[model samples]
Target: MRTRTRIAPVALAAVLVAGGTMLAAGQAGAAPKAGPAVKATCYGGAKYYTSTAGGGSSNAHWPATGTWAYTTSNCNDINVKSDVSLSVKVCFKKTGSCNGWTSAKAGVWTVVAKDVLHGSGFYLQFNRTSSSKGWIAY
Candidate 1:
């Protein structure tokens, strides 16, 4: 009886140690998987890109000051839309270069650029002669 009890404990401890080692080894050998790709959206003729994942309708209107708010993180795309033909400008910073203007026709959602924005922040401006106009970003 003494021998049997001693052997059982030793065997149990060995098995537990081995199992723990195998678990550690398996985790160490596995490569980390990449995250899901972010989705881009075009609404009412404007484009928006975000790392966040979800589905919903987005409002399309220029900011009250004509400047779109953006984060310091990566910006994946530039989108533009309007009720009539208009020009759009995207800048790295508020005071930075205009990058150039893209012409977007009325009622047509357009992607001016994509995968072009890196980690730098950016904003959008809509150039329209008409009093009625709007745009949005994500």
Candidate 2:
């Protein structure tokens, strides 16, 4: 009876140790889960793009290098994200008109432009303190 009791406890301990090791190994071998994707809404429904950060206050012009994606549809609004706090706006390509610049906080989505010029193709403009990269979604 003494031997049997010792054996049972030893077996249980072994089983528990092996189970814990397996659980830890499984977790270590598993692939890391990714964060939720950033999504935005547009006319055709949603869009996003990584763009070069623009610095300084410029008017009536979208940076030639700042655009990452383009659409023919009229987007309801423009959202921007950056490493630094900044301002952004949207402009009609043909009409040469632009909405007022709005502030976007660091690493957050800010509705920069609420009204884009209808029936005209549009692009984004940024006025940042630094040249850090940013994202635009609509």
Candidate 3:
């Protein structure tokens, strides 16, 4: 009778421990939901002179050099580390000599390291010829 009493407690303890372990493992397997991308304003930017002709379709300079303004009210949650660098790209297509970025024409680009952040630079293409690329560092 004493052996039976001891066995019952041990079996109960084992079951409780197993249940707790499973609960922890289940939580670990769940993935966090993705958040939305932040909306940024055109805090400031620079304009570059291009030479081509009818419309500004080409990058003027295949490997052009330029910089744009970026202001993030809150960057606390992003993967951007304290020492993160910056490289912003705007896709504006033209033919020959263009007037630069108009009020319209905007697109998303793969923001990469300008220079400082252990990155070579940012490169993108419009067509086979007119393309834009540059580097940034601090």
Candidate 4:
């Protein structure tokens, strides 16, 4: 014959309490959840300028010359706005190499940057089929 073993209510209560305490302790000793990293803002204030019909802003003059503005510590993209629809791009170095033009609508924040390499320096150029005005933030 098999003998039946039963846990008393008091003993069962102790087991549950101990198990809960162990679980709580383990969780407390675990590492805390990490927070998201903050993105770097533009190094300075936004730049405002005007583009004449079929013309563009002067080459790579913002962020000052010889300075890298889109590195790890700097901005990777820029925010742009305009009074009328326009095109924007990043022109780098003396070769006049540029990223594809990104279209920006009137009064909207359009973030632009592409094919950006670390340590590469660039400036914003705004183009319009007609005269246009805009401001850009790195």
Candidate 5:
């Protein structure tokens, strides 16, 4: 009887080990995950804004959140590009004050590399204006 009991325990252990091994092997064959698409065009980020009558002030207009702002602006300009276009909300004085902030649809500041401009980057922003394309880095 003791011999029989010992043999049963040994058999049960072997079966449990085999089952565990099979479960581990099955884990390796799980499904693969997906991701974002690859871009065929050169990448250049920009911000777009809708024109506002007031913005905030006569010269400088700062639009509050959810406000219809100015048109899309290119930050690559040298002449105060950072202060006007995009999500530009220039304080009449300090940075915290939303004094004269021009509202924009979306603000995107893209960095265009020299090589990228010649290739895929060219296609990203073909509709941009010459004034929009500036040497300044915003």
Candidate 6:
């Protein structure tokens, strides 16, 4: 023969509430916090740019126009957009030695490339080969 023990309703409710509170507290502490914003600096005519540093994306310049060059310290997503015809060249190891290039026609946003960065740095050359327009990167 076997006997079973049942928990009282009040006791079960208390246990559940305690477990839920513990879980809620743990979740609250585990939540990620937002950090300070990164600032991007640009040279040449390029209007917007973003670069990766310390394994995080930083140095973001927005509303960029004309030709510009950007760099990244690690493998991070590089996004580019334009309101006019534009072309981009990606350099894996160095800026001068380009690995690939892509172009966007008319006024449209293009992803350009994704996670093509290296530890040393990857260079992006955005050439606004058309009318006056603006672009952004992240």
Give each model a TM-score. Answer: 0.43, 0.47, 0.26, 0.45, 0.25, 0.36
lDDT (10s digit) by residue, model 4, range 88-115: 7877764568777888888976777743
Candidate 4 global CA lDDT score:
0.59
For this target, which candidate reaches the highest lDDT against the unseen true structure?
4
Give the CA lDDT, 0 to 100, for residue 10 in model 3: 100
Better of 2 and 3 by TM-score: 2
Error of 1 at 13 (Å): 48
Alpha-carbon runs more than 4 Å astray in model 3? 31-138
lDDT (10s digit) by residue, model 6, range 1-138? 122234466678889999999998886665433111121321122245332211133222222323344434321345455555656655544544664667866555455566554343444554532233345443
For residues 100-135, write the lDDT of model 3, one tens digit per residue: 222212222222222222221222223223323332
Q: Which ten residues in a row have the lowest lDDT in candidate 3?
A: 76-85
lDDT of 1 by residue, 41-95 (tens): 2232333322121123422223433445553223356555455676666665545
- lDDT (0-100) at residue 102 of candidate 3? 21
lDDT of 2 by residue, 1-138 (tens): 999999999999999999999998886565233112123223235344444444455332243554433442434456666667767777766667877778778888677766444454667766643454556555
* lDDT minimum window of 10 residues, candidate 6: 34-43
Which candidate ranks first by TM-score, i.e. highest?
2
Q: Candidate 5 vs. truth: CA RMSD?
A: 16.1
lDDT of 1 at 21: 100
Which should have the higher lDDT, number 4 or number 5? 4
**In candidate 4, what residue range of length 10 has the lowest lDDT sum?**
31-40
Ranking by lDDT: 4, 2, 1, 6, 3, 5
Q: Count the backbone clashes (under 3 Å) in each candidate.
A: 6, 2, 13, 0, 22, 3
